[model samples]
Target chain A: MNEADVIAALRALATHPAARGLRDDAAVIDVPLGRRLVATHDVLVEGVHYTPACPAGDVAWKLVATNLSDLAAMGATPLGMLLGLTLAREAVWTADFIAGLGRVAALWDCPLLGGDTVSGPAVLGLTALGAAAAPLSRMGARVGDELWLSGTVGDAGLGLRMALGEMAVEGVLLKRYRRPVPRLGLGAALAGVASAAMDVSDGLLIDAARLGEASGVGVAIELDAVPLSDAVRALLPAGEAGVLAAAASGDDYELLFTAAPAAAGAVRAAGAAGKVAVTRIGRVLAGAGLRLRGADGPVALPARLGFEHGRGCNAG
Target chain B: MNEADVIAALRALATHPAARGLRDDAAVIDVPLGRRLVATHDVLVEGVHYTPACPAGDVAWKLVATNLSDLAAMGATPLGMLLGLTLAREAVWTADFIAGLGRVAALWDCPLLGGDTVSGPAVLGLTALGAAAAPLSRMGARVGDELWLSGTVGDAGLGLRMALGEMAVEGVLLKRYRRPVPRLGLGAALAGVASAAMDVSDGLLIDAARLGEASGVGVAIELDAVPLSDAVRALLPAGEAGVLAAAASGDDYELLFTAAPAAAGAVRAAGAAGKVAVTRIGRVLAGAGLRLRGADGPVALPARLGFEHGRGCNAG
Candidate 1:
């Protein structure tokens, strides 16, 4: 996420026992006294994620943000972070990359901590540490909670399009992809407000369906209300194309939440306090399927949705 | 370091406010008020560090150990870690790679936490999180602090030669390269006792010179007393080839440390408790230089030495 949006979005996280203000070396956390910890790891490779043409500094910044986004999806507060950097062993770029990371990490208050350095292969790997308070897992959303999204959506996806010259947009959407603002604050704020929550790294509609499957429920979204930034709007030919693209494109890094109807006000208030926009997109239902209520009535959803680990998008 | 040594080493870390043990999903750290954090990162690419034919699992295990090894040298307790994994999307050995890492992480007690997973290339990136103790640095050693090594040295260096089939030795030397032991416990144990301490990933003599430069001191090493494992000795050619090779080769992962003479007993005790050997390899002296005393008077040290990030090493 862009530094400003990330700062703004993270600022919404109220002080809690585990994660306080995003202002220390690492997020302090308290876990249950005796349970074997469950930890899973993933890594992103450069050129595979973004082109080398992208700024090295942003590459460093985005790497840290991506890892933190995972922790947010898992309902964990960051404890600390480590980085594994592989560059060409060229003095100039490596130094710049580290300096950029140092600056961004300082802004977020997450210290670099420690990691290994090696030559060969140009890649950057980051490991983020986070603790769960009754982890609000991808498998926990209920059948009746209303579906909600914190802040805008599809900005990063569109931003990437603009970066690649595939689409042209103005304002935030382009900025979103180049730099995503991770909703760490919104994630922590959702702890007591939502039944289940996850960050939208994959496309929202697709991720929503996955969440539904995980929770053994179905989801229905009202296309009219899906939050789309002006940047996403600028990319399409002004109608269904824009809406559909926004719905299926990923990398928003927003907190998608399912909460009881009664808690809607609180969720909105929480989102607003951090100046993040909250939108009611859909509802979780009893059956096991995903439905979209577009302007043309019910329509079949795209099966190839969201980002898969090894597989590229079906659209590509 | 391999899974076993990593477990043994991490288990030996003294009780701390941050790390609970090597068994949690994420390390629970207690950060003090005020003061920001400082962090660094690096990643090792396969074929660059070891052959692709190397056991994939051991390679995975070593990745975490190497990163954690850095934290140990920095005097930072285990905080959290991240992994950036890249593998051929269809590698037959991918599952084995992940499983080996899971096993070692389970033993080390650090959780997998969060990271990015990408397709393309075949490499492993690991980042280790650690709580920083301010004024904690490589530059902490001073003039006159007796230099010490946590355990018997050169086995890994010797192990490398054996791995390359260049040396026809047997016993621990092979395992040495395949499974270097990270001196986590000894390094952590030296936290208070050592004025300056570092894990010897590079050879003893080279790393010693680095410590001296960082601490603004000179160094004098006694060739006769450098500890050598029985496993290493059994495989070495008669004379000083093994000793000389061990002194210059990297990948030892031992803790090379310096302390005031009064702390010698404690340093030795720490090593004993960790089950690693310790020896009076050298002493920090005035001015800036390194001197090695052998039977033939002060022998000329290697003109250029150690593993530089980009420069090719005989071990690599």
Candidate 2:
């Protein structure tokens, strides 16, 4: 389909009143009173972010999921999103992408607002808006806080391996890579509770280091304590080094956060309320860098912490 | 520069407190009570929306300006914006692009919010947020409303010709093409006065037709009444056909609005207050579609209305 035809197809999916029937130059929304608005933008490219063989529907899902993960990290409720889609010359791909976008938007209750569409290499950008009574920030972590993580960390990495044909394409691991879920419920429950928080996109170690840097503290993560799915443990190498490798793999999309030791009970309760698994990974220290520890003691940090753009590391 | 270096450079430009030093996953801002929020997103790709030869700085400027123009059409005040930049492998171009983005953000009082950047084919996407007490809509026009335009309609078209080497590269017309100004002040002044409003990014005739379609009315435009810059008039072909061509050209970034005839004085006063020239070029009729008239009789419509994406028509 051409740009107009694709847009016409998308118009059917924009059911929210704020979308203005996808006719206006922009979308108009009445933000709720007394709530602080949180905004985030994320871009996903074709070859760099996802493999060419990946389904367009999966690409669309990951694009929206990753962006919503940002809002989740902020402990915000999803409101709406604008999509900037640069499509390749594939009509069927465009249709599948829009269908996937609509599906995720409806599932997350983040209605589609308005955005521009263009023709070019496949690069999709989403700007998500949310509302929070008290949003969490990475800078809010304290020196003595306990670090926590939700969900398995390395399934997505194993899924990536399976996608690369290095392993069997099992449903669980492959799903982790193709359709990772954003932890919005747990994040919202953590509002005003967690000292600092962020979702792990570029691997646990790198993202943890970022949280530490933002909070002006240091993180010491126990490698063995890092959560891993049975599929990942079965498929990947065993031991602390394997755990560390999993920690350094990207596209986890799980929440890595810190809270005071006193709030551990509250954190556990919030996790229970959200029906998500919670694990204590490590503690915040009074320093400036990320430290990795194993059962034997302090382990040497890896040469590469996690994925960095242009360094052959994919983002979500 | 790599992605980290580019993000660090952009950090210096993100002086807004809401940006959280560009460290957090998202930016948090409090929208004032009782005001509606307006948002728009646009993407500019290399060799599509703009020529590869265009300065990265100008590309950045036009990207922000065009999104802001959408807000302007809604009579909104600029709040802040998030930028999703997919960069080509050029450090100097990245630096210049960020500099241009920072300049325009400061000039328009729109702060730089947090966004994601990746390395890929250069595609720039911006999502602008704004606030309006009474946002205008294109569905408000009534029969007999006068269609008014702010600023000259054909200058940007002439400027595009200059950029394309079809004419002399004069500063005035070239600047119009490179850095078309958003009529924010005039739009804000017409908040409650304009029956219907939109910006002319596409050709005036095509955009007017869209306004007519949106408002459920027809537009009757007088070819001679369309405003043209002195430079455009001198350099381009002359007389009725020339005016028609100019009206059919795109990227004007001028406001096209309609108001009751009784509000003409108010419209003039608003234009004067905003320091923008206002001219009446058409009227809304109780029918559908657009009608163009010349001095002698009715004029035939052009085969092509205006620029549409993927049709080899450049937007920026």
Judged by DockQ, which candidate is best?
2
TM-score on 0 to 1 scale for chain A of candidate 2? 0.96
> How would you encode candidate 2's per-residue C-alpha lDDT over A243-312 as one tens digit per residue?
9888988888999999999999999988997689989999999989999899899999998888764444
Which lDDT values do the candidates have, in the order given? 0.64, 0.88
**Candidate 1 lDDT tens digits, A187-224:** 66676777877777778887787778767899998888
Q: Name the regions of candidate 2 deviating beyond 4 angstroms.
A: A309-311
User: Could you tell me the TM-score of candidate 1?
Assistant: 0.78
lDDT of 2 by residue, B133-242 (tens): 98889889899899999998778888888888887788998898889898889988998899999999889989999999999999999998999988889876888878
Clashing pairs in 2: none
Q: What lDDT is reached at residue A221 by model 2?
A: 96
TM-scores for all candidates: the values are 0.78, 0.97
In model 2, the number of clashes is 0
- Candidates, DockQ: 0.25, 0.77
